[model samples]
Target: MNAYCFTYLFTINYLVVSVIEQMTDARQSYSIAIKNICQSFKESVEKVESIKKDSDTNNNNEILYNFWHVFIEKFQNEAELHENVIQETKAKVVTPLQCIVKHRRQQISRLKAFRTSTDYTLKECAEKVNELQSNYAEMYRIHREILQTKAIKDLLNAHNSYVLQLHMTNAMKAYYHKFVLPQLMQEFEGIVRENIIGFVQIFEYFCSIHTNMFDQLICNINGVQLKVREVSPDSVVSVIVHNLNKNQNPTHWQLIEYLSPDCDCPEILCSNQIIVDNLVKVELRDKFSELKRQFAELSSFMQQNVNIVDTLKTLEKRFDFDTQTEHINLNMHDDIYRKENEIRKAKIALAGIEVQESSNRYATHQEMHSHSSR
Candidate 1:
């Protein structure tokens, strides 16, 4: 019985050892299969991640290109409008003042295309944005300088007009006092003696021509005032006051009161001629000084506004390029993060397979030992 039991136990042990070996082989095969599947999965995920990254990069680049194109188009339109206006003004006016406007318009047109182009790569866009911004800054500086020039020209024109008017008025006064008044006195004496109506006809014609000249001057001055008002209302007031004060002649006041009825003042009596002269001078000086001060204030305010416009243009240039680059970088970063996560997941799956293989080996070994004991 002991011999039989030993044989049976030995046979059972042999069968158990075979089963354990088969289980180990099967577990090893399964492990290999899992490993291969894990490896394939990892490779597939890598390919997918790579494709996703490529697609994301392509999409980002396309968006950036489109955005740049749109920005360039906007600038182009603005530049075109400025150019057209400048050209039209130059053709109509033919003034040195219009030359500066034309130059700025040309500059705008030259730089408009730099805002976008498919030929430029991502790196080139950054460089171009900076380049364009610098150009724009220079243009702004030139524009301000030109505006200063226009102001100077306007001042010179006003001075010339004042001088011409003064000469003409003095000439007319001299002609009337030296020639016209003596002629009129002689004609009146003759008319009284001979009863002639010729002097009346001559006087009426002379008065009509004088009235026409006066009207013409008034119209010219009014036109100048209108233009000055359009450009800077405060400055027009200053110019008017300056001219009036610089020439304190009674004729100037008479002209002013005649042209602008609102400035009419009632005659005032003074104790002394010197005191009246001094008072007139003081009033004219004070009025002109006030006008000049107000003009200076308005001019300074306009300059500040121009500076603000320049600052905004600078900011726009910076934002246009920066926004596109940042968006592309952000997309790239997201793609990289996504790829990392995919790799991490693949590694985790591989590790789980390894754990299963170890468990199968341990179970097979335990079965073998138990059969040997039985």
Candidate 2:
């Protein structure tokens, strides 16, 4: 190989080394994130277990113990699934990535060192071979072949070894590209499916536990509703009357008047009462507008509710009427059909036409024409 090839290789290596260092940093950060998630998960599980254990000791804690008992079991299943994902990620991606980084750095350094030395030797070997070839005719013309010449044999062996080393490096690069890289990438790419989709499935199961708890509570509520009668607002007045004491004074509490301030004026030099009157009038006008706006809002809200209630009542009445009149409507339809059939029979009689009850089939237009002609 040429000297420039080695120089280019070193340049590429320098650029790639920076990138690999960044990858290493990213891997370390990713590892820390996984650790944090696992640690937080562990603490949460411990808290749940602790709560469950404490609740179990209290014999009267029905809902708490039962809830945690089911919760802990569900959490265990979720945790196990989460742990599997973590292990898979570490095995398939994280650890493999780490090894790739180490192996890559080693290979880059080794290849550069070996190739640089081999290229230097290659230049010298080419010069040696050229010199020997150039002097071969003169040396043979002068003397016979030299015996015990170690230099020629050593030079050839060194060239062969260097060439073999280059070939081996190429083969190693090919194998990695074909097999190792593709396999690692295939495993690494499934990070989404293994972690994201797997976590989704696990979390879906987790949420179902809460759904089941809510369903059970709803069932309890429905049971209570079924056993009890609905209370009416009008019954509150009757209840109050029933509980009232006859001996107690009717007006127990009175409105306490806070002393209103008087104007700082002498008796002989008093101002007109128009100050208080005008202020009261303006305040009352403002209060009236504010109260009217509030009342309008409430009125609109109440009207909307009333309209909804009325529509619902109308629907109820319509449903009830349909149920009650269903048979009558059916009977009326039957009578109308009966009268229409009778009228058709009378018309047939007036027209002096008779249909055969024995034959099921009626004559076609062509057959009727033929019969009429006959």
Candidate 3:
């Protein structure tokens, strides 16, 4: 009914489409970020695993109850959690629903196209209207007996019916302009505002899910850490002494120190002065080199993905979907009212022409009656 409102609605719909495109891009970045984080984390964990591989071996002192094994397992679980977020579920019963988003976007485009096609008056109607007007009677005199006085009365009756239909149409126009349209716009504005609120809430909710997962993981590890702490080197030595016959008791017990993620020079952790090192360095050399390569790749991924996450965070804050849509929605009713007024005037104008045609027809009918009576 309101041209401006309809136009604005279409405009808002296009904006929504644009926003969806941007969201798709942002989601892609998020997936890549998750991928990189998981890969980097896996490499870091593997490095520690290699360093502590033989801590519990036959000839060595164990490192803090073999905690590196736990690190490997935990790292796998942590990576799996993030990987699940980006990847489709492996279950056969639940298929991916990504197609639904695409279909909905297509439907919006279809709606826009359909509305654009049907909402306006056709050129053909105007062209045919220009060819012949209803008010101008044919000059052929096919009904020559028409009388002027009888025709006036008939026209008055027709005029009343036309006025009644026009009255109804105008009443609806008034109701829509004053109440229905404005209220509909207000509700729409609220919807847009709520979407913005939800957008921010989604950010907070996702962050909390990851943060809580990591926190709970740490808590569980802390709960189990006391077991490792309680394991004394003397108890370990006593177990070893009994396992092997007490035939050969080594006087020198090499105490194992942790090779952490921060350690750059892993050679220092190896028990060797110059003579043992000269023998051969072969135990974890391959693992160290492999981890080094993986870490390099992980570092590259981390930089790109972390920057993506940061950009998206700023984008969410900077974007104002509500403000963008509110201006159009709030002004729509006023525009509609003006357009409805135009429609009312056009209806009245056409009605005047049709009423004049009724008078022309009535005169012809009455003249025939007058001639028959005479």
Model 1 misplaced regions, further than 4 Å: 1-277, 321-374
- Model 3 ranges off by over 4 Å: 1-147, 212-374
lDDT of 2 by residue, 1-374 (tens): 12222222223223223322333233344544433443444454465446536531222222222332333233232211222233434333334333333433443344334434433433444444344433432333333234224433332333222332332233333433344334333432332123223322332332433345444334333332222222221332232223322222322111112111123322311311111122233443453355356545545554554565455444444442132454454344334333333332233222211111101012123345666899
Q: Tell me how candidate 2 scores on lDDT.
A: 0.33
Per-residue C-alpha lDDT of model 1 across residues 6-103, encoded as one tens digit per residue? 22212322322232223223333443433343344344334434543654121212221222223222222111111222332233222322222232
Weakest lDDT window of 10 consecutive positions for candidate 3: 89-98
Candidate 1 lDDT at 60 equals 16
Best by TM-score: 3
- Listed per model in order, the count of residue pairs whose N, CA or C atoms clash below 3 Å is 0, 0, 5
lDDT of 2 at 171: 32
Return the top candidate by lDDT. Answer: 3
Colliding pairs, model 1: none
Give each model a TM-score: 0.15, 0.21, 0.27
**Candidate 3 clashing pairs?**
145-367, 145-368, 146-367, 146-368, 147-367
